[model samples]
Target: MSFSTQVKNELCRAAMHRPCCIRAEAYGALLHATIFSHREIRLNTENAEIARRLQLLLRRAFSVDCAPRQAGSKIQLVLEHAEQLGHIFDALGYDLKNHVTYHINRNVLEEDCCIAAFLRGVFLMAGTVAGPDKKSHLELKTARHSLAGEETSLLLDLHLSPKMTRRGSTYVLYFKDGASIEDFLTSIGAPRAAMELMEAKVEKTLRNTINRQVNCETANMVKAADASARQVAAIQRVLRTHGEAFFPERLRETVRLRLAYPTDSLAELAARFDPPISKPGLSHRLKKITELSAAEEE
Candidate 1:
């Protein structure tokens, strides 16, 4: 299943409690549902779990029953009856006779618990969050711009900032940063998904770090091997161009060590000396041998 669906399913398992919070959640769902009006109300979902949750919300919040009208995978809880619509509308503080405003009534979300529940409803109806494997993003899309603006304010009140944009007739409120997405998910009753997102981000960062470290180490080894090859070639030139007698005893010993251990690192070759020398001392001797070899070539 998609990450968004997984979160919704987890949220559906939450026990129905507190009549006010349940009403707030239903209000959010209704406001963002595919079609919510005095004439008809419809909550649409492809997931059977969410469809069931919506049906339960309508019943619990308004004492109204709405069975799923299923056509393939798309499930809809539809209410065309005025009495049922009135039941939901009255619970959300709306009058049956008036036009419904495309905005949130902040008064209905007085408590923090109600605010969270309301956000939960909004997400179930119109929201989607990218999975851990994808870029960090979470969005709520509704038909009206004014409702999006109002929801933006509601999110900000909870210390979470979301930007607003429009696509065709839909107004979108979205969080782009991982931190914001995590917080939003946790706030809307999906802590497991939030933690998974954070874990994925951490694993990705760690893999990148290990890759860079390995590349750097490989580059350094190549550099050291190239330097060793050049040193060995210069030593060979000194031996071939000028005989062993051409060097003093100390330099001759260094030449013998180089010829014997062409692949040994400077530190390893230095330790093989009759009386071991420091790596810097061995490097200085090699440099002198190269100079002598160049002099012979000239």
Candidate 2:
């Protein structure tokens, strides 16, 4: 299953025996579902776990039994009966006959646990999270603009800064950063999914570090090889134009070492001297040889 599905399944198993928490969760689910109003209450989901959870929440919160039906790959839990809808609205503290527009009822979410349950319900209805291997994105989509705005406020009240945008006909409340997504998943009772996101972040960071180190080492080797080749060429030029006997003793010794080990790096060549020289000292001798060879060519 996808990571999002796993998160929802984990949330579905959260214990909900408190009456206030149950009502809060059911209120959130109905508000974010496919259709929720005075006349009709419909919830649709492709996830079996979410469909099952919604049905259970409705029954447990209001003592109403409503079963979900499978249509192709999607499962839908629909409540169309006026009396049943009225009962649900009554339990959620909404006046079904008078209420036209839906806004989050903050009074229902007085406690932290109630808020968490409400958010859990919202996720089960319309939430999605990208796998950490891809990108850190968690969004709740709704067609009702007012409900979206209210949900954004609710998230802000909980100290989460969610970005809002419109996608086609839907309003989206989303979190992009990994830390925010992790906290969101944990808040909604999906600790395991949050932990997985953290692990993915650590793995990605480690891989990037290793790649940079390897690239640095490869570049150093290339630079060292290029310098050795140039020094060898300069030494060869001196040997051809001016015989070895014409050079000073130290210059002759440097030329002999360069010609003998054309592939050795400056540090490696320096180590071969009777009393080892520093890399900078060996580089100075090579520079003199190159200058003299250039003068001869000119």
Candidate 3:
């Protein structure tokens, strides 16, 4: 299943114990419903859990019944009669005389529990979170700009912030950073989803770090190989241009060891001595030989 679907299914497992929270959650679902107004309430979804949750919420929150009709994978609930719509509109503090404005009523979400529950309901209907294998993204989509802005304010009250943007006719509120997405998922009772997001981030970071280290080591090996090749060429030139007797007596042994192990690094060459010489000593001898080769050319 998709990450968003997994999260919603997990959230559906939350117990409906608190009456205020239940009503507030149902209230959030209504505001984001396909159509919720003075005349009718229409909810459409392919998720059987969501359809079932809304049915339960409508019944428990307002003592209203909304029958679900199934066609293929989609289930739709439509309530149009005045008697059924009146209970919902009145309980949510909406007047039957006015059309729905789609703005959140802050008074209904006064408690912290209710606020979390309400946001959870909102996500069940309109929210989506990308899988950890891809990118970190979470967004809530709504048709009303005012509702989006008002929801931002509500989130701010809980110390959570989201950016608002217009996508065609839809207004979207989203979180791009992982931390914010984690906070959002946890608040909506999906801690497992948040932990999965964190794990994905950690894995990506570790993989990148290992790649950089391997590249650094490979580059160092190439650099060392190039330097060794130049040293061997210089030593060969010095020997070809001048006889072994031309060397200083103290340096002849160093030259012999170097010629014997052309591929050895300075440390390995130094260690080959009967009484090991220092790496700097070996490097100095090699440098003198290269200088002498250049002098012979001049």
Candidate 4:
């Protein structure tokens, strides 16, 4: 399957059992989280599109009115019914455990790259200004901005760690800014999303690995078949060119029948020839043809 299809399939499985779930919203959050968690650099156009899509999803899924605030850099969702929205998402399987996982193993580094972009967008859109902290990594600055108009600053630090694999690469994300990761997760209802998303990622990776193995096997079979066809053709060409004029009428017929069905064993070929040629005799004919072909090539 294509990479997009694979990601969709993983999403489908993760979204299973929560038909009433806010699929688009949750997926948007995941996508946003993914982009925001990793990359340090991105184009403005790309960031805008992600923000637009995410805003649409959140609005559609949660019925929560949200607009791009902070000079079109952050999204401001006025959640007077925060508890109600939380309950709905919780019912729909939104949790921190669901979001933290390596969803697809194929092109892992690339996948992480996408996730980082997503997280960056999410943070910016969620009214959190992201910039380099003292350490020069991404840090979420949620202070009462002139645009936010007296909202308290909420500080959170998100970080991604590169992991080496036997054949490729992978990544993991953490909220380095939180005193307790669990507390932060519980507050945001991320565990359910985290757990489901992580499971989907693992399952998707396994499927990809299996597909690669299957493709390799099929390619090997095709190669073997082609080689066998060439070998049989070579034998026939040698026999026709070098030995046809010397063979007796009956011997010629017997040899032709054997070569016509090259896969037949010597015993099967002998049965078709009058007086029943022995296995050794059949072997001699084939060996002689091979020798002729080799000598001609040399």
Go through the candidates in order and give the C-alpha RMSD of each one to the true structure. 3.1, 3.4, 3.4, 15.7
The digit string of per-residue lDDT tens for model 4 on 50-95 reads 3454455455555545454443554333233445345434434444
Off by over 4 Å in 3: 243-298
Query: Candidate 3: lDDT of 191?
Result: 92
TM-score of each: 0.86, 0.83, 0.83, 0.31
lDDT at residue 53 of model 2 (Cα atoms) = 84
CA shift at 38, candidate 3, in angstroms? 2.3
Candidate 2 per-residue lDDT, tens place, 188-219, comes to 78999999999999999999999999999999
Residue lDDT tens for model 1, 40-143 = 99788898988888888888989999899896779988899999888878877887798887778787899888888999999998889899999889999988
Error of 3 at 262 (Å): 6.0
Worst 10 residues of 4 by lDDT: 147-156
Error of 3 at 298 (Å): 7.5
lDDT of each: 0.87, 0.86, 0.87, 0.40
Enumerate residue pairs that collide in model 2: none
